[model samples]
Target: SIDRKVGSQLMPDTSPGVSRSSQLDSETHPHVDDTPSSNEHHRPTPLPAQLQGRATNKTFQSMTYVPGLTPKIAGILQSKVPEGTVITSTMSRSPPPPNERSSVVYRLGCKGCEAKYIGATVQKTEKRFSKHRSDVRNGILATALSRHTLSSTGNHEFDFEDFDIIGTEKVRKKLMLLEAALIKQERNRINIQEEFAAIDNCYNNLLLNLNNH
Candidate 1:
């Protein structure tokens, strides 16, 4: 009988025939993620921080979007004059009567333009003219005139042939009315213009940045 011993028993194959990679289920395979990770939650983002701190100035560039003057704004208009009654004590028992005159002077100043007008006012000088400035700045030129005559006092007193001494209040009203009329008559003659619209647009953009923030 021939000796028939195998040189070494072949090791029994323990591994499956399929590769380890192929053993993994397709659904369980690791996915390549492009999204931000949870660790990045605290990272400095590009959006909110980028848009902050814009439009923080109050210069001409910041005044855009100021609403145009409407009747509602007029109601809010305030007088520059202090509200009170004036009392004067005179040497004589009978107090001297108040002086009334025609033609008040209005000093209207803009960024570069300055206008002088002689008109009448029934109120204090400073208070009445403030309205003129407001109206002029708002493009309501019907309130600023070239020649306004009102009840003058002290150094401001001046006489006009057509005008008479009305009470201060009457003078104020007359001055305002005359100024308004002159502004209307010369509305075409007066070369009035403004850049508020443009300024407002720029400011509006600034405000938008604030809103977005």
Candidate 2:
């Protein structure tokens, strides 16, 4: 018969205010809730310095930001990218070293036009054709096709293999000079044929007019 408050709005404290007994369930239950609240302050979380931007979808939570790195570390990061990426930089560098002897197609022939061209590379082959296309389109190299040679054919069927690379600057210059020489030689041959035909036409015309006279 413990006297306690019990009404429509307020519930009775049936147990006689025991501090640590099963009878004191409401107070003990809320003390259990306090455990969770206490844990919130101690819960492990990634520090801001260790937080990384979301990679793909999963957040990277263990990386720290480093301000600067040695050249060796910089190189490691650069190499992580898959090959075929065009690398442009402000640093001036000499041309690549001499490569093994390889074949290069230097000419394309048609009834009215002949194009002399140098194309292809192999040391790192993945994006060589891409570079060639960019060069041709940008007018860095003379090209037989307005677009990439591969694109003009609409398939991989027109792709030609170039095994030869005049690797050093000197050799590259020499190959260029040789290409010019070959083009000049062809022009000379075409001129001779045109001149000989002209002469023959003149001679035949003269003979016909003379006979008529």
TM-score of each: 0.20, 0.21
Angstrom error of the Cα, residue 44, model 2: value is 97
Show model 1 residue runs off by greater than 4 Å.
Answer: 1-115, 144-213
lDDT (CA) per prediction: 0.35, 0.36
Number of clashes recorded per candidate: 24, 3
Error of 2 at 50 (Å): 91
Which sections of candidate 2 miss by over 4 Å? 1-128, 134-142, 147-158, 162-172, 185-213
Give the winner by TM-score. Answer: 2
State model 1's lDDT: 0.35
Predicted model with the maximum lDDT: 2
